[model samples]
Target: MTRAGRPTRTVLAVDGGNSKTDVALVREDGVVLAAARGGAFLPQTAGVGAAVDVIAETVRQALAPAAGAPPYADHISAYLAGADLPIEEERLRDELIARGYGGSVVVGNDTFALLRAGARDPWGVAVVCGAGINAVGVSPGGEVARFPALGRLSGDWGGGYHLGEEALWHAARAADGRGPATALADAVLACFGTATVEEAVIGLHLGGLQIARLHALVPPLLAAASAGDPVARSLVERQAEEVALLGVVAMRRVGLLGEPCEVVLGGGVLTARDPLLMSLIERRFAECAPHARLVVADVPPIVGAVLLGLDRLGAPPEAYERVRAHFSGAAGRAAGDASGEEVLTAPAG
Candidate 1:
């Protein structure tokens, strides 16, 4: 909706992750008309049908505020977690286009969004540590470096999921006196409310306990590390090393290791601002890439989606500024307002 009889130009942007997905309808001038957030849309985890259904409904609601206006946007940008490979991105893009989601659809790994959102230029590295770990780098000349990120099978490591599993392994080993004694065994037992680590492990194997819930153990493991637990501290240090290594490798591949480079850290574990973890990561980077500018992303991933969309649309500079102001002023929560709905929706404006 625009002045008297004019229809405004808009872009449909999406940032889909493992746990949540955010969609936005942004006008050419950067006015966010509507926004919506929903559950995961990962085809690998949710199946293709359910993933499409969830993504479609989420986008529909995001465009609901402006009813009869051409629903067609000048461009659409979708950054999704499971769209790791180029073929995967192309398939998803075709699906979105088949549904008439936009005039043109562009899809890429969600980590690229994290990278663009935190760094001003395309030349930098981004390491995301959340449900999983991923890294991407872009050089000044437009070359890129990225990982498959298909879990341990792909030789990838370090994330909440992996850290929690490591915690379980070390705790179980300590409980059986096969490894050095540490506070993790007691902490792990306390986290699961079990009498002992053995009970917890047995319950997990017998399906009495949820293995998916291991991600919740990350905080406790880090807390144990902060409390001087040797095993826990070692786990945390290893994660930091892994993160730094990912960034360094990406930088080296792009021939930016010797030059000053921006290394962006994002996702759940990194965004938590854990002192020991952050400091250890800094130490690791200091030893390898001394000129690295490490930045912990403060903006939401959707912001990156919108920024990319704006670039595609060739929107003016002020357009991007308006969008940034809206996000930053709202403290980066797109759904900061309550619209009196039973289910929460991220505010589009």
Candidate 2:
């Protein structure tokens, strides 16, 4: 698709979440020139203007490494975590358009990026469980299923951030003898390198500890769960159950229950490959829908963003391969490759 001149930035793809955002610059023919990761894109917590700044800066970083990327792109597609409601998506879209990063702009829920990245069949289900939890389902008959995903108010559950908070709560209670004693208290101390939960609390209140670091505690929490910590184990189980519940509900709503369809999962929690969580999900899902095949999304969600851009271009298969090859040496590449037509992740819908 290129003539004699350098390649221009035809598509700008972004995957924005509560914790982080990724941006990539792609040519019209689907060759990725640059991909970069940046700060959080949670408009709810960070204000729309600040969140948009982060996104724009990340877009700049993406184009930074590209030798021939145009200053303006033909299209910019951003899937953001806090953009759950239609109003939110439109507002964010308008803000992005005002920045003039691209001639055309589209903003959607971050789950949609995961959906397009993981699903290749044009219809299926996707459940994302990283810092937060959300699900989306698309049916062949053109039905769509999703949730407000506005956290507790919207009946959402099972995410790394929640898991960390629960762990902290139990640990604090155990320290004060108000709850059943579990290994989590000492585990928390070891994880944070702190003397006591009291010290941690005081530090946080005194503006010493960054509350944002709370989500990072998820790994230690999972470790404690795996090491026979009852409360931790219970929390992990609940998360697995929630993941299963979301998938089952989404599929049922879209009329994909018991059908031979793909169930795609992504985010840090599911990607951890935890034995208890994985087994519980498999067992619970099999009971609900035995025929639904499950897949753990291996590639970065930004790849899903790229796929969304390519879809609009209706690029040839070879163009897809070119884009996949551009990410071949990335730190987050899948075990094999996405150079083939097959989608390595995302839901079909």
Best by lDDT: 1
lDDT of 1 at 20: 88
lDDT of 2 by residue, 130-160 (tens): 8889999989997999999888999988687
Model 2 ranges off by over 4 Å: 2-9, 65-71, 332-336, 339-349
Q: Give the Cα error of residue 35 in candidate 2, in Å.
A: 2.3
Cα lDDT for residue 225, model 2?
78
- Number of clashing pairs per prediction, in order: 4, 9
Best by TM-score: 1
For model 1 the TM-score comes to 0.90
**Model 1 lDDT per residue over 44-76, tens place:** 867656776777778767766554433457688
